[model samples]
Target: MDIVFDTQQEAADFYRRMPSSFRQVTGVMLINSRLAVFPQKTADYREFAQLITRYIIEKYEKKWIMFIIEKYYYFTDAEEKVTILNIVAAIFSGEKDDLPHTGTLQDRHETIMASLEGVLKEHNTFSFQSIIRFRLTAYREVLRQYVEIAIDEYKLEQEYQVFVDKLRRIVHAYKPLCEKIEVYDEHPFKLFDEHHRLIRNVQSVRSFYPLLKQWGIEAEPSIILSLIALAPKQVIVYTDRPEHGMMKTLHRVFEERVCFARRTLHLGNGSDYSG
Candidate 1:
């Protein structure tokens, strides 16, 4: 869903309007994704680890097929949507596997709340210390997700158009998501695109893959999809994978194609593109 805040403050105001709980859930989801990137000894799941390894071997062709199965959803199919709507009330009346994944992130909201409460038995602080301690890891994670998507030029040609199309729709369809404003004792933070650096260096694919795997991250295709959704696919999907990123990838892949048509891309300022 596209949610464009008129201003950074407007976005913060919208987040505040949501039931305080939903925001918390979003925070948890984002945090959990972060943890998945660089697992902690205390939190790592051996089984999940093996799954990830096997997932890598599989070349991640699953494509979230189960999501489609569970959703029984197709964006272009209105009749199927109507069928799901018709069964909404009686969905619970089903046999076993019909249930959803009961992972901690799901079907345990109340229990998680209780667990968080037990851990948060401090001064109800939300102090700078508390914020950093609880949130820095995840905030950095958000940045990393942005980075992973922004670089990796190899996949741009394969995916930029799809992403640009998606972003165009999302940005166009975006509406102000929040209407309620909360009185925050601590000033909220904002996201700035200029804050990110773009990558352009690369010579060959072999050199690129090792560098990418070394980021100590599992670069999922969904990341590619997100890059497509957020920026130009041509900006990513570089023909040669050296050390690159989402935008760099597009530059490599599409710069040639569009450049042929005299549509050269300008990959601008970003962090020091280094290992």
Candidate 2:
């Protein structure tokens, strides 16, 4: 029989004990699962949000069912995406377990958080693990800042500690799955486009993660795109002012040059992203 939980700890415990065949952890339902079984240390919100978003969307959203957990919901249908993500703000800033999903601005904030959670995970992983690194050189500082702030806002200190401890116990725990994205003296993941793209976008390989996420990448990889940086392709980021036309001839360039850096940069090369 299908079950619904109004609490994280309760669901976590149940999901942990249940067989994977019939039951699974849905969205933020990790309180008593393996997390409950183990002790926590660094619940960094950056990591926490990312993991929660990924887990929910990857497992439930694709199923085309709106699995709403207490306040958190996972459904990819464009119309419902924003409404569900908003549920996090209630969870984040201390709202009731069953938040009112009205079309209010408060709900809007929560919705944005959920969307950010999904986008941030893709961006961070791409920045840290992509095959191409040099292309990301320019955005490294911004990306790091993002991680710091998101973690802080998410109240993720406990999560971060837990990740560190778990990573230590496992093989290649901190080892990234992408490629050179993290090596750029920074990261590759960024809030790249104001709008999605096609040809010109791919020309500059550095911004692949943001672009991929915008494009709603089909491979749906939790992979490190590259470990070794490759030569970056140039593209212009248009401006909105009068002098700089919407299509100004602004050429975006990489801070450095990389070469045949690493192969199998992403995790989906049929290999494990963690490995």
Candidate 3:
């Protein structure tokens, strides 16, 4: 029999109390089921539109049906590869939950308050904002790499090859000629692509979460990709929670390049970042 809970805690407690078989079922669902946000209006529509346009002609679109929850759909496609990628992108794009960060109501309440204040406020007195910004900058680098990878995959796909090739040429040709590409002193040149009026055609895209998720990376790898993209000379890890798997991965990946700094920090900003 299926069970429902009014509160998430109720559900968690139920799972914790379950027999091993039931617990295994829960694990399978979490791992195999593609997560989706409810209240369909919140799902990234731009990504949905793109997914339809990209794969509708592939002739296998009907293999799996979209698991609908109200207006939102999870696992729009049946293919495992495509589905995993979409989930990854959606999670990174903040379209879905961060399973690792899930916690009690107290943690959520604190996060909500912090988010409400907006971490990067111009008037805030938080001394740790600089560190947060630095961390964010590193994350952006990782996103950029994934963005590139997604584009490359599109270009290589047989169905998308012609369109991708044409777009690539246009982008390359427009590169030298477009005087509109704004160059930021501190940020990567790719970030400016959105600001150009000529790219307005592409700018209408509100979400690439589905496309980005296709990479099948967890939270830390996503962050690490962003760090690599930024290519910082030095990095300091500031945190109150030592359980983050990404930090451990960083110790092994970057070795001496990364170090920990004990700081009293609060979660900030739940806003979804653009790719």
Q: Highest lDDT, which number?
A: 3
- Compared with the true structure, model 1 gives a TM-score of 0.18
lDDT of candidate model 2 versus the reference: 0.31
Task: Indicate whether candidate 1 or candidate 2 has the larger TM-score.
Answer: 1
Which runs of model 1 end up more than 4 angstroms from their true locations?
1-16, 20-121, 132-134, 153-155, 158-275
* 87-123: candidate 2 lDDT, tens digit per residue: 3433434553333322222332233244444334344
lDDT of 3 by residue, 106-181 (tens): 2222322233233323222232223233323433333333333433443345434343343333323322322222
Count of steric clashes across candidates, in order: 25, 42, 9
Query: Is candidate 2 or 3 superior in lDDT?
Result: 3
Residues 1-275, candidate 1, lDDT per residue (tens digit)? 12222345533443444444433433322221121122223223232223323322233112222223234333235543333332321222232223333121222223223323323333222222232245334323332332222222213523555544443453234342222111111122111122234322223223433433443333443333232223332221212223435434433333432211221233334464231
What's model 1's lDDT at 141? 35
lDDT of each: 0.30, 0.31, 0.34
Per-prediction TM-score, please? 0.18, 0.16, 0.19
